[model samples]
Target: MIAYVGDFGLARFLSDVPQTSLVGVKGSTGYIALEYAMGAKASTQGDVYSYGILLLEMIPGKGPTDDMFKDNLSLRHFAKLSLPKRVMDIVDPVLLEEAKVSQGSGNHTNTRKRMHACLISMVRIGVLCSANSPRDRMEMKDVVTEMHAIKDLYLGVRIHQDEQVMSQLSGEDPSYLSYY
Candidate 1:
């Protein structure tokens, strides 16, 4: 499969031929969807599962094959178990530190809250997309839409923060707060 980044910064892959079953499995071990191992054909659903793994990896900065994923634990389960709570524990330390620094500059309670929500939503999408059953996984289009929504929320908060900083620097009225 050939992969390229789409306009939304999402990776899109193209397969030259239609779906078909091969004699044997071929793909990175951690990324190959479970169905393929069970003699299922190459499919969009498999691709979605791999994409989900990719998304999950982004949160904790750990690959599926990481040493920590031995035994019953896996990247998917690790992320899924932390959802809606314990996000900070699973999130990358660098990101948490960066958030702390950003929160120090101003009244960042709103910023912190928005960021937390975005993180939870992202982990949820990853978990949904990587469900064990292909039928349970989200479609690629829906994943893209949900991702865009999260991106918008994140960027909105960032933009507001930037404007607030600018206003403080320029001694302008705090009118930008009204827009958010």
Candidate 2:
């Protein structure tokens, strides 16, 4: 239930007197798509575009800035090109470290393989969500579903690891959770 809290028309109205609904152009610059800024009617598609931008923000932990996109090097453009590997280059360093730890240190080749697969899936989703064209982007419903699937998969792995840890604590299998 992520929500955008900014200068959208609806937010403006909420700030106004007794249930006033603001009527006019709505959106924040830079974050909003070019079409919306050009007086195109706001619709679910527009919201999708904004959501894409929001997704980019979440990954990078920073709003899109003019300097970040010099001559078409913008996140949107980069993502649309399916350059998730390159995108990974700009991800927050903290996140990179966490991802590395999550995908490493497993003797069971299958477990390491699954972790790598999940990490790649997540990177692909982030890239797709930030595509340049609205039509080229994934629907919010699809995005939500994909996110849930990834989360569930990761959680399942964590639960399995935890169970093995408990088993080892009970001396049932001392090496059950060993990653070496």
Candidate 3:
């Protein structure tokens, strides 16, 4: 890994490693896409799949090779099954708790909505980038655009509405807000 990093100056391999049994260059299992494993011609799609796996791993604080996964369960499969509805269960407990505490104490519906949107966007991006079919994966340019948008939201540069996050800390859900 160090050798590749030093060569490319990339923190990790974004280009596909040759599948030859010769010395040098070996791809890790689980992270490698089906095409790469099948010894097909390499493309940026393979890297997108790997990046998707990496992003998916961050949400649950688990790896593609985690022992808890059994049978047909993979990190991608787990993420696919636990989105939007049960996402809270899959997210790291500390992050989930922090979201709840922020929403609860801040008592701001806009902030809560923004947080949900941010998480959903992230999970959706990961899933899209890591789709089994290369055709289904997002292009690197699109990924960069989405990532910038996410960063903007994360930095509190609100995109949708100009409403400020309420400063008062309380437990009450605002009465006027009706989310449907």
The number of the candidate with the highest TM-score is: 1
Off by over 4 Å in 1: 1-25, 98-106, 157-180
Instruction: List TM-scores for all candidates, in order.
Output: 0.71, 0.58, 0.69
Error of 1 at 62 (Å): 0.8
RMSD of each: 9.9, 11.4, 8.3
Summed backbone clashes in each candidate are 0, 0, 0
Q: 1-180, model 2: which lDDT tens digit per residue?
A: 133535333323433334223235455665665554454455455566666666666555556664667776776554434332344554567765676687666555554344434444454555555555557666778878866765655556455554443333333553411311
Error of 1 at 71 (Å): 1.4
Q: Locate the minimum summed-lDDT window of 10 residues in model 2.
A: 14-23
Report the lDDT tens digits of candidate 1 across residue range 98-169: 767765766476566567766776777788878899998888899898788667665564564544443332
lDDT (0 to 1) per candidate: 0.68, 0.52, 0.62
Query: Order the candidates by TM-score, highest first — what do you get?
Result: 1, 3, 2
Model 2 residue runs over 4 Å out of place are: 1-23, 80-84, 98-119, 157-180
Put down candidate 3 lDDT per residue, 1-180, tens digits, no spaces.
011111111114533554453233335556666565555545677778777777887788787788987798888888877655565578887776766765565536666656655665677678887888888888879889978876666556765432332211111323212210
Clash pairs for candidate 3:
none
